[model samples]
Target: MTERESPFIDRTGKSLERPQDQWPPYVIPKEAIDLEIERLADLPAPNNGRRESFIAHPRAKEPGLGLAPGIRVSLSVLKPGERTKSFRHTATEVNFCIQGGGYTEVGGKRIDFKQYDVWNHPSYHVYSHVNDTDELQVRLCYSDAALLEMMGIYIADEDPPSVKEEERDYADEKNRTDPRAKNPFGTFQLTDDGAWLMPYETLINPETVESKAHHWPWEQVKEHLDKLSALGKDYVGRRLYLLYNPMTGRTNGTTPNFFATMTCRPEGIVDRPHRHTSAAMNYYFSGRGQSTVEGEIVEWKAGDLMLSAPGWAIHNHAAKEGTVYELTIQDQPLNIAMESLLWQEDLKLPAAILGSEAGFGTNR
Candidate 1:
């Protein structure tokens, strides 16, 4: 009987054997891995520290679902001579030209954006988009009530107000004219001296944020983590860049609010039981591992999102050879505003820190 048909005596006479090496064949330096972690930790948030802006055409496609909460991704299509109304808004927004071309008019200035180009708009900016493309498409990423509420900056206008030209004038007067502005998002005044809002810094621009090495620079990635580490309050592990931070005008770098990080566990690696004060979510990027979230052993994989509420629990991570998901938070804003932040880095140390091992495992 063929191996497939034979229950015993070797279907096809094949035998399976476990390889001596469980991890991937690739070699990875601990220092290099630590540097990568630092890079992610040092990523900078948006600010007048850099000039950031974009002009998306009217005809754009919808941006797909993202990991952030309370955000909606969508696309728009604009035809020639089709102009959008100019309005003042306070919600953060980003857009990328997917297939078409278009121009946006802000403060009576026209900026053009084409496919693969990204644009960032800060909160409380007066702007509008128009489609002047013969055949262009656009996609945009933006947040709704969910994001606003998280930052404690939500505003509700239950009633629509009549058009006011004077209000438009005030917005137009605040328009930025400096070509050297460094922020990718539109600039906003924090003080009379000119403090630019940088809510888009963490979302690095391919054309901007120079990095000479193979990996992203430390400041370009790890600044977010550093910010969280600085906050000495109920801080726990985290996942980052889920959304834009209004205060810094950046993606997921350092926020005056929340933070996160993904952990990596090579095959056969196990992070012994440990606990912390901050609640967190683990977004598995790859590999196979089991995390004892609270008490239950949770098997994980790529794209899987796990949660860990605040306080200590018997949590451990194990994998034959793969990367583990990681996310932690101390609720920066909640602690800062309430003046109740605290942290203990050395406390409840896990036996194996993520990225401690050097090697790879199964490709998956």
Candidate 2:
């Protein structure tokens, strides 16, 4: 018989004061992305019909290679008249169209998107991308797959089967009427301090909220964002709108793991220096800008993607010319749900544990 080694490590009297090593801000220039897209377009279609490449940070390690610690960004290209095989994964995703137009079939719904459009994919929902146009279609897909991969539980199925509509309806009805699905004793308060005792049935059969795919067309969002410039130069808050998904509830996200916001910055406008525990990545689609991250200056222009804010790193952005349009994605919802979202809207003020504490507000 083989003997197993002990899994315990003795840390007696050892100091537990290890400081976190934050990753440095990185940028993928527009030229590089364009070159890659062209290269992808020239390659023969794979068996799966998915031509994709991950944008990884230099500091990232294997098993979870991502531009940020918790966020994975991938550049995917589909040639004209091409489509990908059906796929489903346990990780949720935010999909942003960068070039051309295409449609996605996800969870039995078809969402047609154009350039600069934003959409989300719910976890475990079978999806496929199709490029029915005459031009090559490109997208930037952001996901929490890095975090899941780090936890060693990232799951993906190729060509997954679709759930039959009648079977799904029948199963829902059965679960609704099953006696074992209900807890007779119910969850009751056990102490004055808010502790409660829950039965096994209740623990296993929690309320289910339908997670759906949502689309945010750029033309529609742009009209509303353009109005933010009317707020003038005195506005303290960011000129952005979050692409919200109702299923996330109080977490305020487009998906369970991340929040996607479209920001419109007028010429010469600068953002205040601030820091947050959640990392941020931005894709600029219009005009030019410069971001100061941890005292380092990084300039960007239209079609550039950057890791503007590494976790807890001080950062600020300024528009250089024209109206700058950018799409920013952050793993803020996951942090809030974990009670670890620390945000400092103003450098002069102390950081707040956002979600649990009152958040900072801006004047108009």
Candidate 3:
């Protein structure tokens, strides 16, 4: 095909077979490929101080590494005996330990960390990290840029204060020393020899967070909600509670992680259709509602689930006469990591529409 006359049209409206390497021929859009290529091309060549050519963000700055809207990712390296000063961020974080070992203090609790360990920091919480190992160390950080932007927050830090002599308290070490101290709050049930998570379970035990600074299992949380509803105290006008499970932020450090939250709206409530940075699945329980998923009017009843992936169009829900409930789970870490969240409001709710594409997740 000639450069101007071709059968295939790319996102940039260029001929597919052009020799200029505008895009990957069969994969991503030519415009997207051009964007990526342009990004890579903008990087300065490696030099003495910057040994790593692909060092995206060398500085630990706030809103540090912006890839796109609503996402921020940063990777850092620490040489032996080199460590970061105590710092805090307005962004919640999920971090993966790529190499070496170190010590981390979150909310005044010190935990020894090693390769493959994951760590999470709640939004705006002060935390510190140190590397005492003899080898180079690295970490991958993911944060929600959109949420932070909405809240008008950023990461800030001060130089590490000189150490002072104070008696360290090992009182919180009871769970570490005792074998019978497992799951004092029934957070992670002993499914086998080790603890396994159930989809609907919640971490009700306050000690779980106190000990590990992380919350897992949502079943117990659900039971807590059940009791509140039984007492007629619905979950409305309450702070949006979250079960933060960072994929690489867990102690065990696994990927493809899951995080979910329960949201309820009393009668005559409507949440406008919007898109987010990640693919999400909403499990509706114990309520009736009308959900418009990507232009399809989906009447959601109890036991129904709705799913929407990135760029899958708009989605929103409206409650019936009584309260409406739903649990939304998403790969938020990835979204926050990649920064591709989108939303729209100010327009009236679209008229009820219908389509044959209405369906729920298979696991629903």
- Best candidate according to TM-score: 2
In model 3, the number of clashes is 9
The residue-level lDDT of candidate 2 at 81 comes to 95
Query: How well does candidate 1 match the true structure in TM-score terms?
Result: 0.34
Question: How does each model score on lDDT?
Answer: 0.40, 0.92, 0.47
Better of 2 and 3 by TM-score: 2
Clashes of each: 81, 0, 9
Candidate 2: Cα lDDT at 63:
81
Task: Rate residue 205 of model 2 by lDDT.
Answer: 66
TM-score leaderboard ranking: 2, 3, 1
**Estimated TM-score for each candidate:** 0.34, 0.93, 0.36
Clashing pairs in 3: 71-339, 200-219, 201-218, 201-219, 202-217, 202-218, 202-219, 202-220, 202-221
Candidate 2 C-alpha error for residue 98, in Å: 0.3
Candidate 2, pairs of clashing residues: none
Candidate 2 local lDDT, 1-364, one digit each (tens): 6866888878999999877667988999999999999999889899999999999999988888999999999999999999999899999999999999989999999999999999999998999999999998999999999999999999999968885532556776788689887777788999999999998766776899999999999999998887876877666677899999999999999999999999988888887898999999999989998999989999999999999999999989999988899999999999999999999988888889999999977622
- Which parts of model 2 are misplaced by more than 4 Å? 1-6, 10-15, 165-183, 233-235
Once superposed on the true structure, which residue ranges of model 1 sit more than 4 Å away at CA?
Answer: 1-153, 156-253, 260-263, 272-277, 309-316, 325-330, 333-338, 344-364
Judge candidate 2 against the unseen true structure and give its global Cα lDDT, from 0 to 1.
Answer: 0.92
